[model samples]
Every structure is written in structure tokens, then in C-alpha cells.
Target: MPAFLESERLVLRPVTASDLDDLVALDADPEVMRYLNGGRPTTRESVRRRVLPRLLHEYPCLGTPGFWAAEPRGGGTFLGWFELRPLDDDSPAEVELGYRLNRASWNRGYATEGARALLRKAFTELGVERVTANTMAVNARSRRVLEKAGLLFVRSFTEEWPDRIDGSEHGDVEYALSRGEWLRRHGG
Candidate 1:
């Protein structure tokens, strides 16, 4: 089945080769890439050769487990993408949830909405045991999104990044929600 998920105002479709341009453009925005790559723009060649190929490879064996391009539901304007991938050495049924939205789309609640929808799908349909997301400690906006989606702060760990941005020393925060926790929160 073609990987497509929908929210009230957004459409989520698997990232394909045709989405290279949109992906590149999204990653090129300095503010968008700030916490990720030290505000450095990604080269189109890298996006095409490496990023696009990786996304395409995930289409088959990954089992609807890759990044999905996010667009406006009615107009199909590219907003950004959401990633739901199984961790290395993990079963397909267990996945990590993530989102990256364009700066223009920030503060509009798209990220939180999309993430909540995915979490719902995972728990209700995919038999997911847990869903987790990570972000820089200083990224209060992202941390808030995860919290709004019902994930609780689990840990803070440091990893070597390519370029330390303005707030790397504080470490990265991990947020997670287990199937039981999700069910409890919903009074199931």
C-alpha cells in the first residue's frame, strides 16, 4: 500500500524521488536547519544522491516506515515532512516518531497535530509498543510539541554533533510514551 496518512489540515505521503526538490528546499532554510545542522544549508547533490536514495530504499522493506512529505490537505502545498522509522535492530512494529516543518509552518500546530495522529495510528492500528522523539534541550518549541502529544521527558544525553550549535552542551532530551501510558491517558 502506498504510505499515506491524513490529519485535519494536512496530508502525509511517503517521501519519494520526486520529493527531492521539496526536501532540499526545506533543509536549505537556515532557521529550519539551525538546530539540526548548525544553520548550514544542505547541498542539492547530497539531498539527491544520499537523502533521496535513503528515502526510496525505505519504501519497500521498511513497511510504511519512512519520512512522509506533509502538505496542506486542500491545496497540497508542501509544508515539510514527518518521520516514523523503526530503530536499528528493532522490529517494524516499534517505531520512533519525528517531524520537521518549514519555518513558515511553525507555530501553526501542524507538528503537534501530525505527531498526535501518527501516535494514534501506531497505537490503534500498528500494534506499537512505544513511540519516542528527541530534540535539542534548548528547542522548547519542539519539546512542547512532544509534550502536547502526550510524551513525557525520559532522558537527556549528549552525542557528538557535526557542528555544535548554540545549545549543544545542555544535551539532547528524549520523550516517550508507551502503549500502556497512552491508553491510560485516554482512559482506556
Candidate 2:
């Protein structure tokens, strides 16, 4: 397994072909998918054929950067996954940071902890100029995670959705933090 990073309470590692079941289970939870896919569950086959292959392929072409499965440090139980995908336009030092955790891990600061670690890696190791995250405008929980990680709200904008949820009309919010901003927040 290619380990990308480690935080105080979590381990961030690359996704392997064997991680399909864990990924499927995480995506199967309705609450986890509420804002992402209108609470629609993803099929195992879709993950096997589409998602896993794409993630694996991305690592090589993108300089070993892609999705990392988050596991508890001591026991290494799969909690969820974090993504640090490079922009398709090939912009250097510009990547999106995102996470999805099991419902069991909600409100426990796992997301914030993992995100902060990833942000640090992006700015310091990957030479990332900026890091961005986005979630449903009504997802206060996710927004709080972004804020706790030192990312500020950049905008709230509406986009067409194939499967609209009750709050889809409220649009989505984008949060961002530059490398300089992160440094200032850390007083380094």
C-alpha cells in the first residue's frame, strides 16, 4: 500500500484494488450520500468497474496523487477516503481536497483532522498554491469541517443537478485556503 500521509489519529493511504468493499460500504450509506447523490446508493459493480479503475489510473499519471483511504491509526480500520485530485487543465499546485466518512464517524473531528493533514501536505510537499473544497450550501456539518481546517468560504453558487434534493435549490458553497493563508493560520 502506498501511504501518503499520517495525522495524529488517522492514516491516509492510496486506494488499492482490494479496497472495493470498504469503498462500497461507505458509499452505500444514505446519510453519507444525501448531498452527493441525492441519497442514492452506489452499486458495487459501478465501484468495481468505474471508480476503482479510475482512481488507480490517476495515481500514475498524476504523480502518485489520488484518493487515499483513511484508517484509524492504531487499529487501521477503514473510516472513509480523502481525495487530492489535480485539476484536469494541468494547473500546477492546484488541487481539490475532499473527504467522505462513514456515518459512525460524524462530528468526531476525524474529517477536520484528516483535512488539516492533507492541506499541510498539499502546501508543503506538493507545492500546492491553493486548496479548495465544496459541499452543499445547507451542509452545515461539512462547512464547519472546512472552517475548522482554516478554509474560508469563497462563494455560494447554484448548479444543475441530475437528482435534486430538497436543499439543492439553495446551491453549493466553495471554500478555499491558499498556502500563504495556511502558513499565517499556523503562525509559521
Candidate 3:
């Protein structure tokens, strides 16, 4: 499939059924799942039944799948996935941005690159007014990526987690960027 977006080092394409194995393997790394589920590996059955379907669903607002598999520009490997999904299925005015990468892809700037590219698309082409993201307050790495992608820290709040993870006690932090704010920052 053609790319949904691209950055200097990554290509974002709509996720497909063929990506199941890669998704399973990405979720298998305990370190990768630490903040998400306290190092619990997501079972293939779970990925197949629940995760893949969510990733594959096309959002009417965007007229495309909300999740995109991340790979190298030349199509090397599945580094992970990125999401720019509408907060409401029928509206593109506000969206949630997120990413998950294999441990090998971490600390290499792929996350920031892909995120900035998505932000650009959201504001300039997708008619998105605001983009928001949340991560565990203790996830410094993810927080840094959000900042680098131009999202400002909005607040810290707690929510019920079905199964609490290691840093759940610290709550979660929300970061966001309004289209107006983005344009000011980018001199648009």
C-alpha cells in the first residue's frame, strides 16, 4: 500500500492483516510493554482478535485507517506503528496521537520523526484543530518525544486502569497542540 505519510527516516502506511506477526513480536518484548502492562507480553490470540482489528479499522472521518505501520523509507522492516486517530469517529477536528515501537527502534528518533510528520498532516491537510497524547507521567522518554513533536504539557490526571502497571500510581500526563499554536511555532 502507498504511504500515509513519511519522515526523514520512516514511512507510515495503513496497517494490514499481514502485519500480525510483526505486531505480536513487537508486543512480546517485555521492556516494550513495561509501561503499558508491567512487562506482560501480549498474546498472539489477543493481537489477532482485538489489537489487529482495532488497527485495521478505517475511520470515516479520515477516510483511512487510523493506525499505520512504521517502516524505513526503503521498506526495510516493521519498526512499529503510529496513530493519528479522531477522538470522535465522525469528526476530524480533534485527534489522538500515539506510537509503539519495537525496543530496537527506540532512542533512534523514529518516534519523534513520525510524530512531527503526523502533526504536520493533522494541521495542514487533515483539518485537525488539535492533537492530544497521553502517557504515564513516569514515562519520561515518551514525554520527551511529545515535547519534541511540539505538544505542550497540558495536565496530569489519574484514571482507572483495569490492571495497574508499575508507574500507574503517578497518574498520566496529557500533552496537546492546537492548530493555532502549531502554526505560530512553525511560522505558518
Q: Which one is best on lDDT?
A: 3
lDDT: which is higher, 1 or 3?
Answer: 3
Which candidate ranks first by TM-score, i.e. highest? 3
Model 3, span 115-169: residue lDDT tens: 9999999999999999999999999999999999999999999999899898899
Candidate 1 stretches greater than 4 Å from native: 1-3, 59-62
Error of 2 at 146 (Å): 0.4
Better of 1 and 2 by TM-score: 2
Model 3 stretches with alpha carbons more than 4 Å out: none
Ranking by TM-score: 3, 2, 1
lDDT of 2 by residue, 1-188 (tens): 65789989899988888899998998899999988988888999998988888667554334775678889887778898898887653554677889999998888899999999989888887777888889999999999999998899999999987777978889999999999988887885
The order of the candidates by lDDT, greatest first, is 3, 2, 1
- Provide the overall lDDT of each model, using Cα atoms, as 2-decimal numbers: 0.83, 0.85, 0.95
Candidate 3 accuracy as TM-score: 0.98
Q: Each model's RMSD to truth, in Å?
A: 1.9, 1.6, 0.7
Instruction: Give stretches of model 2 more than 4 Å off.
Output: 59-62
Encode model 1's per-residue lDDT on 91-116: one tens digit a residue: 65567889888998999999999999
| Candidate 1, residue 79: how far the Cα is off, in Å | 0.6
